[model samples]
Target: MDYLRSTFVILTVIMTILTLLPFWRNQAWWVRVWDFPRLQMATLSLLFFLTEMALMPFGGPAAQIVIVLSMACAIYHALWILPYTRLYPKQVRASRLNNLPTLKIVTANVLMTNQQSDKLLALVEQHQPDILVTLETDLWWQAQLNVLENDYQHTLKCPQDNLYGMHVYSRLPMQDPLIQCVVAEGIPSMHFRVTLDSGDEVVLHCLHPMPPSPTEDDESTNRDGELVAVGHTAARASFPTVVTGDLNDVAWSRTTRLFMKISGLLDPRRGRGMFNTFHATFPFLRWPLDHVFHSKDFTLRDLQRLPEIGSDHFPILVELALNPRVGKGQRGLEIEPGDQFEAREKMNNAGVKSRHVHTAEN
Candidate 1:
């Protein structure tokens, strides 16, 4: 009984610390990684709190303190994720008038090593998105996706074996298409202007920065830096914009929120659901590493997390309408009091000195 009580107390303390770590603006991968599991942490914290309460009589004052702290952690974590749930107001307004011009996009990370082109191709054919952005694509994956070239005529390819590759294919005509590395070496993000069938032009930026994991980089600095840089670019762009890809960060992270404020873009998932996309193989462990954010000029037509396609990540499909008139109703974010200084600090810490994209080699 004593051992059990000790173990529980230790775990509660650790989880409580993890729940508060992301608030400090620390770039350590371990600490920032905690930001990905808020939902899970909330659940676990609640469970721990209940268990602590049940055992409070058997224990002592220390047990009481643990129970109270765990309860607080549970509440805080829940509040952090509440906005991403249906309970909160949607940041992007939904459009009922489907008659308006819409752009449907499907963004997927092919898991670089996962040889499942057929599954992805099937989804593409079924969804028939106006634009398709694939991340972690290698030369082999690019070749596999070549079949899409006929339908998606405007193509931009940045295939690499480095697991940071990207490719964009669009049925609509695209202008000023660019492939750029916004942070780390060999990692590429795509930037372009797509002319909708209605003849309206919208700028698009796609990213798949490396996560803070042992398999990848040491910290979230580069990831945060790339996002700030992109956010700044999106803010200054003349046309309405959309940014999408496997961002390698969760929607609830501070960096993501900062990016939203810096760019003035809205997340369609605000009131929809988590739509957790990564770790398709594990039901218990997953988060929304994939994302799509757009300017106030657009409204949500439809959004979905598509069925798994044999990769670690399930693709996300979103349909948005370019309606500037309804933008007033949408919930948007603005730069915070210290946002400029923080953005600059993040950019500097990320060590991302260049935004040049390395062209894909044959």
Candidate 2:
């Protein structure tokens, strides 16, 4: 019994230490693989508490101390994941740009297999956004969406049977709408430059990358690599950019945070609520996977999760304003340059790359 207790205690301590290592103590090779320390901390803490309850003789004072420490670690993990409580107060930024917002855009992942085209069309007509992005679109889906071409003159479409099909429609002038094969697998993504009526130039990148799931990719490394590489590209671009899609990753994950840092993009959800979109059929398991991240030049006016239209994912509509007065400093979060460099290097090292497609000059 003493040996078992000691083993449990030692393992718990090791995991707790590992959880704390990612942010500060260690950046060594082994630590990088176990980089998501918060997850380890939470899991290990739960295991320790469960072990104490299962043991024939409950742990003594030492065990009580361990429980307290474990609970603290768990709380820390929760704090990071649920950052809005700690980071955003009153659900609004103090920046001056919030005064005047810009064009409204809608992004939806209408599952290709979903049959309700009329419902989706109805929503599009009702919303009448300046820009619309649809993912998981196949050739048939493309045919169904073609009806909106009358209103939206500028368009980009990459319809496929695979999970990566994407389409973008814009009422504003779109320059250089082209399909880019970012990864080697010929997975198509659309990139273009949009000229808003205000004469502001905004670069738009619409992507639908395969996420890591048991039935999907064997690991999340590819998805992480692709996202980071795109983030690097977006960061380097001159124009203010908007990246929208079903990223297949949660908003609060370490990978997403690293992407935001490298891309210098602002998540509207930071001060707002989590606009969970996926698994529309199962509301309980849904998460904020579909995202619209923009450069600091833009201020979010409003964001809402639209009603479902037979797809497994709900649409996200956001109204943004070009806040010329809003500078990068208005971003409440601070990310280290070293971490950004490391994230970019890791992405490049993984062999995932992005390609730029130049549309014809308007």
Best by TM-score: 1
Error of 1 at 359 (Å): 18
RMSD of 2: 5.3
lDDT of 2 by residue, 31-88 (tens): 4334333444565577676775576235578887766666676677766656533345
Query: For every model shown, what is its TM-score relative to the native structure?
Result: 0.95, 0.79
lDDT of 1 at 121: 97
lDDT for each residue of candidate 1 in 1-362, tens digit (9 for 90 to 100): 77777888999999988877877867878878898988899999999988877766556678888988899999999998998999998888889786788899999998999997999999999989999999888899988999999999899998888888899999998888778767766988888888888988888889988899877888888899889888887777778889899989999888999999988889999988999998899988998999999988998999999998889999999999988999856767767799988988988887653233221111
Q: Report the number of clashing residue pairs per model.
A: 0, 4
State the weakest 10-residue window (summed lDDT) of model 1: 353-362
Give the per-residue Cα lDDT of candidate 2 at 72: 71
Show the colliding residue pairs in model 2.
Answer: 101-321, 102-320, 102-321, 176-359
Per-candidate Cα lDDT values, in order, are 0.87, 0.73
What's the distance in Å from true for residue 245, model 2? 0.7
- Model 2 lDDT, residue 62, Cα: 82
